[model samples]
Target chain A: MAVQVTQAGADTKTGVSGWSLSIAPRRGALSVVEVIVLAACIAAALTMTNRHGVDIMIRTFLWAGLALAWNIAGGYVGLISFGHAAFFGIGAYTSTILLLSYGISPGIGLFGGALLAAAAGALLTVVCARLRGPFFILSTLAAGEVTRIAALNWRSLTGGAEGLEIPAISSATDMVFATQWPYVGLVLSYMLLVFALSVWIERSRYGYYLFATRDNEDGASAIGINPGVMRVSAMALSAALTAIGGTLFVQYFLYLDPTHIISPDISFEFALICAIGGLGTASGPVFGALIIVPASELLRGWLSQSASGLYLVLYGLVVILVILYFPSGISGAIARGWAALTKKKTS
Target chain B: MGGADKKEDQLMLWVEGVSRQFNALWAVRDVSFSIEAGEIVGIIGPNGAGKSTLFNLIAAAIRPTSGDIRFLDHTITRAKPYQVSRLGLARTFQIPKPFRQLSVRENVMLSALRRHRTPHRANRLAGETMEFVGIDHLADTSVASLTVGLLKKLEVARALATEPSLLLLDEVMAGLTPPEVREMMAAIAALPSRGVTVLWVEHVMMAIMNVAQRLLVLHRGQLITQGKPAEVSKDPAVIAAYLGEKYAARS
Candidate 1:
């Protein structure tokens, strides 16, 4: 009925409430293994960029960032939006359009694009405030499709269905880079910025509010949580972050099109990545993006010659297994295993 | 009982001609009453008599079709539930709506957080409230796994943590055993001492009779009569509509 009805990210070591706060040892948002994983992510970003292929590493970081953004609404607030690509497209289009046509730098365009996407997100959620479950999902789908159509038809501004290209000028100020390493650096910073934001949210009072609002709306309201207001704010924040990801995407690719950027498939990818990693938990999205992005990319590389769509079919099978058996995503399963192992050691 | 303590009678709530209609039928029709500060009022009625609906109207979960409700000086007839709650009015559900994923303490912290900005203060407030309701032992337990008695206690604890001047509880004693009911009754009886006025709706007659200073009886969406519980219990209309002939004959 709700997103992540199973474990999700709710096994949160961020259990800062209860008797744990007073007597028990404080567990930071990330655990030991999680810390190692995060460190590895940084280590991989710095050294393995040249060795393990820059394309794969960068995509991992970017997808992880996008997944975390999606999890804020879909996992934490129980707003399963299949319309994130709209924000992504808005971000991509806004910056690319401004930089290419108006002689404006991409940095200023970045904030402008994010703000516009945030407003669109808040508007979409506020309009569909009364909807829940599949109805809300369907409304988001409709919203995404409408945006895609508008982007496709708005030729004079968007460069139409043909798409727009960024200047290949290699300048530090332009945000364009000659080597793949800077793009990797740019993507890593974006991912870390998003991860830090997620951790801050998980530890802050606002994090508790989002969890309460998502877990039980009426119960949250009884304590003075305005569900409508909270949902709208969350939608805006989530969309703004996702839009930043979109900007990163355009900067890296130097190209933008309605088909690739604004497609509903992109939106689904963001949500699916979160779900498969662990809904509602901080580490779940990172874990999901880390595993799925490379796995699918590798699978596609190997399977394309033998059979078309086989990799995706296999990917679909993996998601179904996780949703059915794991339910809490890969992070949850790992947390549970870690718990059991610790319990045995102590006993 | 009109034999109330009678000292802290500062009109906490005023409901004037309140009526809530679902389409044509009035779920609560022309119900009017006033509760004094620090007084515990019990509202009782048979099935479909609008007891829960009255609580809903008072809590601003649903707006009344007509009339006004005032909490102290605030006109709350059309206020949103959160706004009403923020104005020192808090409510508990007939069926407890616990945050299932949250630990019991976290559930209470959700309410306490409104009163205390810092999580530490909220945590402390939640602990104190849980202590009041005698559920301190279940602090770290997940809400989804709580038993019925503990769930009811958690429900009361959550509302109490909000630190409301006025509390509305709906059927908190239902499904509880004799010992659980006694424990709950004792907890509610302690509300007044904390400067909390209460409006409780319950089918569990014995529990309310022990806690309320006065009683209001509803029949068919209208207030049949209201007075001291001792007096209202003996009224002919209340006896016939609710307590019935068997109890009437014995009394």
Candidate 2:
């Protein structure tokens, strides 16, 4: 076993470690790889028709951020929340209300929304931390449903189900960009920031506590670590990050409806990405976005406005297949394959 | 127990008049004991004797119905389990509770990580502790693959990783072979030399007798006897509680 670990370590040093060095040295090679990938994506985005390409890029980047945020609590902590859309809706409504009614700068609204989402996530954590397995899932689902209903009925704040549309920014302070390239740049920057934060959290003491709590709550507590606090903190950070994505989403689309933002499907998509990419792995969210975003776009394009339900069916099928064949998701399968290959080579 | 010597050997743990009731049935009743620093006290009782419950009280895994426990000059009668652990105490479960997905080394590292914030130091300490428990060979092996004996040793290694001053071990030798039992006994006996005190609950008589400075017998939720191993082994109360006619026939 020690020999196996030594060999694995040596292999990782040469390949993954080299990659780590090229990026941010603190983040190892993965950061470098991400930067390279982002640059290539930008180059690809430039090749398409200016308007459509930029829109897709901005939306994709926002989804990537949301996926990463979901990974922190659902993946790393093994909490498997199915109600992140609650935070997304909260962020969108908070930002929209602050901007249109209070005349606050959209940037301030973004920060305000994120803080609100984080506070809500913290509140949910206190109620749901001790509930595990299916009960936790049920509790979160109920919470999301309540948030959705509240958003729909809160006519004064949310403008009810008809939704609210932001007028043209008419100013730089609104965080509004003039062209598609600027929007893409803004979204990509936020994506990278969220990605970096997720990686940092995963390597920290709190991350270890989250992982330990997931592995053995009693054992974690026996070591004087408070699993409840760790889990709540993770969830709060995750929700805050997701809210940032939500704020950007509203800005890019210029609209916020409770149904659009707080849809159960959005939450399911976040879970699907984590499941398909490999929960609890640093690279899983990136890999998940790479597959899910393009596939979803293609599915929608093929369905061609008439068959939206078909896209849903396809998504459901993909989720089922991924769960059935690779319970640990794509990264887990890849890790296993790599291990087998390494063993075969050594033998 | 003279005044000065008693002061020098002041009790590290004091359990006084602790009891727990489930309706009319008393699971434990007025059980009290004191343990001083550097003591290796053995708790032995037949199944359902509430020996495990007593350990739970000291570890604060469960709250007593009534009574107080003072540890290190503070009353920790209602302290949470994790809080109890933070106050320089650690314990192993009767059934080894190795973290299933973690490697043996990683399992130990998790506890060490709590003590040492830096990963490098925690990893090094984990390796050393694993080697000490004689399971260093299985360091990288996922805990799911370990044998029962190796798992028990891993549990001990994990407890040791906390750098605890007081250690509680429950039935660590429950299913080990004779040689494995001896190996465990030697490792436990060596603990005090490294400044760790042990309170072990064991059904294995020989292993307990070999390592314990004093033997404590629990019967029906009360301390039946406690003394030097040789003296306690012959006490009529202990004999009545544990041996009965079998002891007379053997003698």
Each prediction's number of clashing residue pairs: 2, 4
> What DockQ, on C-alphas, does every prediction get?
0.50, 0.36
Name the weakest run of 10 consecutive residues (lDDT summed) in model 2 chain A: A7-16
lDDT of 1 by residue, A46-78 (tens): 777354467988889998999899888897788
Interface RMSD of 1: 3.0
Tens digit per residue, CA lDDT, model 2, B139-181: 7667766677787888899889999888999899987778889
Q: How far out, in Å, is residue B134 in model 2? A: 1.6
Residue B226 of model 2, lDDT score: 88
Number of the top candidate by TM-score?
Answer: 1
Interface RMSD of each: 3.0, 6.6
What is the lDDT, from 0 to 100, of the residue B125 in candidate 2? 89
For model 2, residues A5-96, the per-residue Cα lDDT tens digits are 11111112112112234332121125454566667766766676756545666677778778889988887777788899999988888888
| TM-scores for all predictions | 0.94, 0.91
